[model samples]
Target: MTQSATRSGAPERVGRFELLVPIGTGGMATVYLARTRLIADTYRYAALKILHQKLAADDGAGLADLVAEAKLASAIRHPNVVPVLSVEEDEPWVALVMEYIEGETISGLIRAARAKGERIPQPIVGAMIADVLAGLHAAHEATDGGKRLDLVHRDVSPQNVIVGLDGRSRLTDFGIAKIDRTNATATGLVKGKTGYMAPEQIAGLKLTRAVDIWASAVVTWELLAGERLFHGEPMPTMLRIVNEIPARLRTIEPSIPESVDEAVAQALAHDPSKRPATADAFRKILVDAWGNLADPAEVGRYVQALSGEKLDRRRAQTEEILDLRARMTTVTRHAEASARDTSSSKKAPGDLPTRLESGPTTAPGETGFASTGSLRRPGRTRALGLGIAALGVVAFGVWMVTRSGANVAASPTTPAREASSSEAASRIVVFSSKRPIVAVRVAGRTVESPPALTLGVPVPTGAHEAEVVAADGERASVSVPADASQVLVPLEPATSAIEPSASAGAAASARPTGRAPGRLQPPAKATAAPKDPGLAPPPY
Candidate 1:
């Protein structure tokens, strides 16, 4: 288990979702890092946002709002808009499950920068804002069935925009979104953050996509100014937004281009019609002003540099989770075995489920097998069959062991790796080979590579004899302690000489100075530690 696992006990289940860790919490909902199985035994990560207990107890009205948010966001399938998978109805608790974005919020990034007595690069900020606008435009132009959704994201604060580690900016949380077809909000009630709210929104006037346009402009202003664009109490802030603009905005960043300032000021125009006609227009203006700076990879680099420690801790915690899953699998197998043994002694024929009661119908006068009724006897024939099946299973297991070249230790020698505490359960050695690695023997267990390169293979921390054999009979052996995070084995064919890439060799040989940065070494070059365990934050 990772360190966090010991500190906070992992929740076994939250509805049908397996809660891995608590990622973030807000006034309306608490988000959890979770995983759920999809089709074909595949699993996907998701952010499960469940309404707070206090809110859920209010006759389910709050739950309805969550459902509405999911519905609204699900309809708009843009890359920049965070995707909502479903609204799960777990009894007594409803959750809005969204595509798990493995990255920090823009707000979190700003806070981290402040802590370091620095600011995010201006170009990066401009790029992120552009991405947000692109997503907002998609939502505005979304269609429901054959009709336009006419969706307006009323809440477009920094908290709502998630900058993923993959360097993409996604707009999330459409809980307060205004739709033409539905009226979830009352006519005169105000919504959205006070400082970022538009004049029309503050007055509870009829809203269009321009409100989002206005909020987006305010966010860009804050990013550049390094402070809130509007201040004071809520009422005063609303009045300021309604009646005035940031007169000192031009003076806030002397280095900012004049054209950029003029564009932002236009978007913040008090009159909605005077603002850019659509989010796309505003985005175009900003992109031109910023000029050739939107690289998702840059955002990815900044996030990794800022959150290296937090991410490492998460990775360590993930190891514990993987170990737990392995244990659960073992338990399930044992239970199945016990059930099969019990069924072998069952006396009642009716105990079988409805599907097993009948056999394939025989063609007219074609008798390849006995009738279903004739096979009902559970005495000598059944016992004999069970014994034969058990023997066959054992023989298969033996064959598998032999085929994988797993041999019991002839004599107890020195261990290969140093043993770690419970934390080691999550620590694994990742391997990437040029050729197909057919079998990997680690800690007395043989792991068969599944068509793809085996990234994370758990080996106990201590002296361990690890061996890798390729499909073409090429083999490589390594005696390494599990204490090291990763090990690279290049199983080249015996006849041909294999040359390793310089970068990969350097990465493998590089000694640890401190906690490494989040960027992984190129896969072709070196075998780096897994950035994310199978259920971790982001792939990159």
Candidate 2:
């Protein structure tokens, strides 16, 4: 993984898509949050991602690896792994549209915790590690035709993890990792975070499931120890990892048990076989070790010895306020992994798991679709989503039949073209924000837009309500009609809704202590209903 070069070509509208804002920049490409242009009458919201022109042109940009990661990750269904919502291959820059994670990194969380002179509780840390393992376990166990996929998380560290205020822990960034079943590493070059790298990994030895176990152990120690355990300072960190022994947990905190110290020391063992047999095993051990001591401050003298105040979402990480949005962003289930139909009839391949069940599976000229079997025709089956070509043909045919059957009584010669355009222009106009909004629809198709929002997308005509998803991975939809003009939607990390009550405290406070600027309102008096602050479209 060499540092990616600058992109070529100027930023310009590729077609009807509108680029929203720069989401982030990595060693390889600049990620932008964008929107797809909606039908002229239906201003529906859609997200589009573009590979930086320069990155797109690079032979080493590894398009195959990028697509492979998408395909692999798209198959797994763990809550922590961000899902790949869409993929567009043939383009100037191959764009991998995905369920964007809007939150900050675990590293950011650690930095915040340290600033507060408090450390994440051992149980929370253990749980966070467990979340990552659960994701890995799902990926590792994923099988295609009885063959185990045999996955390995090459990079497992705080930087790749995101812990949200909602108490959900997620594992992101699978692009750079490798799976034992499929060779995914970049040859002749090293990847993964230093200091967290296991002894075997540092020796340039081939990695296995054990490698991840070691990294997990190191991360667990970091969260519990409150400082870098391998080597605290500069170059020495990597050096001491190879030469010197790490300070024992008991030395740092006398209250620490012999088992906890031995467990960590054993996990850092030079031999992979000596480490915990699996991530699950390590998690169990730590969970037992942290039984009642989840919160360090509740413990003895060690708690007071810590300088910084124990803080949480509110005051621990001011720099991560923006990062919190990414972590807390909502999730959209549009790409629902289709479950096998419980019918007695013969089923199709899609009737089983593993197939990517996303978007409109309908054939040409259809409005609704069935997951299994062939496309159901107009009078036979209900399919959702048809292409413009087919819809146009149907529209033209319907117009012809209507014209032929119209009454002979006609009005005097008048400029009918101007009258039609004028009338259409005067119709109701509706729009929504980057966050999810529900719109009423008469049919699956959109009719005239309502006059609610001046920006965002207009709900397609004809439907009373449909789910609208944002790139950030959050989802919300309106069941009511667009005629309502404005909607009160719950939105977050990915634009989503904040429950009327989150945890025991948020219900009492009524305000997200760390929501984006003006994005949240102080919760009103005790009420069970979620508050909807007429949100303007996001400026992204």
TM-scores, one per candidate = 0.59, 0.49
Report the Cα lDDT for residue 508, model 2. Answer: 29
What clash count goes with each model? 12, 46
CA deviation > 4 Å runs, candidate 2: 1-19, 30-53, 179-188, 230-238, 254-258, 292-540
lDDT tens string, model 2, 357-422? 344456645755444444333311212232333344434543332232111111111112322332
> Worst 10-residue stretch by lDDT in candidate 1?
1-10
Top TM-score hit: 1
RMSD of each: 16.7, 20.8
Best by lDDT: 1
The global Cα lDDT (0 to 1) of model 2 is 0.47
